[model samples]
Target: FNQNRDQITEQLFRLFDLLSITLSLLLSMWLYSTQFSQQYFIAGTLAMLCYLLISSATNIYHLQPGRDINHHSGLVIFSSILTFMILLIAASMTKTTADYSRVTITLWFFLMCLFLIAWRVSFRRIRLNWFKDKRNLKRVAIIGANDIGNQIATSIKENVSFGYQFKGFFDDRKESDERTAKNLAGSIIGSFDDVVHSARNKEIDVLYIALPMAAEQRIITLLDKLSDSAIAVHIIPNFFIYNILHARWHNIGSYQALSIYDTPFYGAGSLLKKIEDMIIAAFILLLIIIPMLLIALAIKLTSPGPVIFKQKRYGINGKELIIYKFRSMTTCDDGRAVKQAEKNDPRITPLGAFLRRTSMDELPQFVNVLQGTMSVVGPRPHAVAHNEEYRRQIGGYMLRHLVKPGITGWAQINGFRGETKELQLMKQRIKYDLDYIRNWSLMWDIKIIIQTIFKGFINKNAY
Candidate 1:
């Protein structure tokens, strides 16, 4: 079925990347007319090692179908920058920085980054053109006209670069059966017997069985029949019938297991997220310390309450934490029925109105980020009272707690911030929040942070 071609493509990409890294360095050295010495060799080796390691972490070798270059090139650039930093650190630690030529190294880094990013765009275009050849396309047939089968077909149809030419659905149901009419979007190509016949005739390359787990014996019989022919078969899991939230499959002992409710930040991802939060939060605190102090003084003078307002909010895994905000209201509300601020809420002090509108009230939550109770980017937390109110009212409301609450988030950057008085507004915000968690990546966090700096800070609906 050519399913294993992905691994082959990945290995090919790795080899190409290794050669480009080496060749880029050589090109730089030749341009500078510098002789290749032992120090340069060691430096180049270290750089290659660092880049390969970082690229693996970034999943740069996936080369999957429908990979948008704009969505991924930032990560390639990020890996390049990280590799450069590690190389610099290595040279400094070993006290060998003086041995390398700066111009050569700089040129090499730029060329390597350029080549890595450029090749992805070029390769995807080339692969798309290559897939246009009918001979290279895999003829796929699905054995069931179920929901799972339909979804798989939809995905394959949308992603043209998958290089799969779907033949049609095959089912054993009687022609007059109501299930056939209900489930089949198009007319079935033939019965299950016809599937085996097509496989034997080399007309179908890949077959996906989407029968329910209850039909184990029927599936076994079909598999036994298909085993006579050289064809690849896959089964779509029934567990997908449930709401899938970061579901993953793994081998547990001699058996397979699937985790339905899981966080994206597991193991290395957790460490990376923590490191990202710490570094960014620390750097921000340094720059905004003076402004924070000024804001605090202004809050104390303008309002009767404490400078920093505290409220309970859900953190990662539904753990309650004290969220800090500059006191932007005269009344401190943190009860079972705290109210949302409106446009002309009288409890808002004069300076508080500006703070709320500008989102300066959220500045103190940067401390929560460093304290590990929050992140620079995530699903923004709501007050405990409002959270409880919506927890039952919303379908996947609690899912947002899969990651730490953030000072600013995907919702904020997308203009989903401020008071969510209407149910639809909050639902849209929750949708974006879940989307962020589903597609969490270091580059995504960086993108959100950059966006927040430019436009997320000042929102008309924030109050």
Candidate 2:
């Protein structure tokens, strides 16, 4: 049987999006006191064609793993922008730019993107609350007792709005086998025979075959048995589960390559990240320029060093970047054996203590953000000495360098700012940093920036 579940979901998204596009264009027409014209109709048709192709290619309308509300909104806006640009390019090529009203095109672009995001959010909220229908809810079962199977179960359990009710797993392995389930929902309730019986009885709506490739014959046998039930079944490939952090497919001359330890900031993702950093950094730099200048002057008068201390730190892809901050210490330690600043350390001047406590010392780093050496929200770059030392001792420590360093970060906001003297503390900080890299979005960055404004600054841990 085909996947009626995903088919129905995709149809709903596709239909609603087309309707939104049509309505947005009509509104734009009404706004400009213009009636429908051939040019307008042509533009609209081309936009819809571009959207369908791009959206389908990117799998935008489908529910996927690791796609949160922000992720959905980002993809929708991205697809809409591409559609708008394609239409503009087509118009330019046909030398028909003068045929359509610029005002109408501008209004349509704005309204289309806005309406697309708004309608999806509104639909999600209403579907979850106002409708309260449970017809689409499916009872799912996994045929494997492995890591990927358990991960799938966890995803289903967590995304309650997806309307999946996991009905435990099915495995033939004995209790002593290493493949037995661990800490998963419901645990192994039955074997393959039981799963088939339940499927035939109409108790199981969806079946996920997460068996290893080595069990090809066993999988074929199971598939043959489940063929009679008419229940939808899908296979969970082991390769896709090998690494989940920033995992995405790349096409190289018609070949698919999976990057295990890769950065998310590539191609359009890189542009989006830079745009986010630039806009936020510019706004912040304007607001704090005066305060940063005052802090720089204070450091100059109090400390016997440069007002702006630049130290070597690892940036994106482990590139050495000169990170900027107001010199809050009496000495500038940029050497191989830089010391971690400690509370009441003699190296810290009186003014430096207040600056660090209030996080005014980091104000200068906003300039670094504007200069593209850093980001407004990312993993904070450690001292070159700290980075080198921890890379050897801490697992996945160097992975934090996958993104540009930042003035404020998930780690800093979660009280990992200031000196991490203990190895365990540094490990915890790196963990949060990696987490941020794994699930970064513009909305996530904005959330961190807002959190930083309220409570991230003036942390008790800050020296």
Model 1 lDDT per residue over 162-261, tens place: 8888887898776468776465544578988798889999998999998888889989999999999998998886744433535567678999877665
Report the lDDT tens digits of candidate 2 across residue range 1-463.
Answer: 2468778978888988888889999999999988798989988888888888777765677666334566567667767877888888888999999888889889998898888889878877875663245566788899988778988898888876756778888988754576586676557879877988999999989999999888999999999989898798998876435454357788899799876667778889899999988887788788878887787777777667788888899898899988777888888899699888888889888998988899888887877887898988889888898889999999888988888888889898778998777898998898899778877777667657656765678888788
Model 2 misplaced stretches (Cα beyond 4 Å):
1-15, 31-59, 74-114, 125-135, 144-148, 172-182, 210-229, 237-309, 315-321, 324-463
Task: Provide TM-scores for the models.
Answer: 0.70, 0.56
Score candidate 1 by TM-score against the native. Answer: 0.70
lDDT of each: 0.84, 0.81
Best by TM-score: 1
Q: Which stretches of candidate 1 lie over 4 Å from their true place?
A: 1-4, 172-187, 240-280, 283-312, 316-364, 375-403, 406-463
**How far is 37's C-alpha from truth in model 2 (Å)?**
5.1
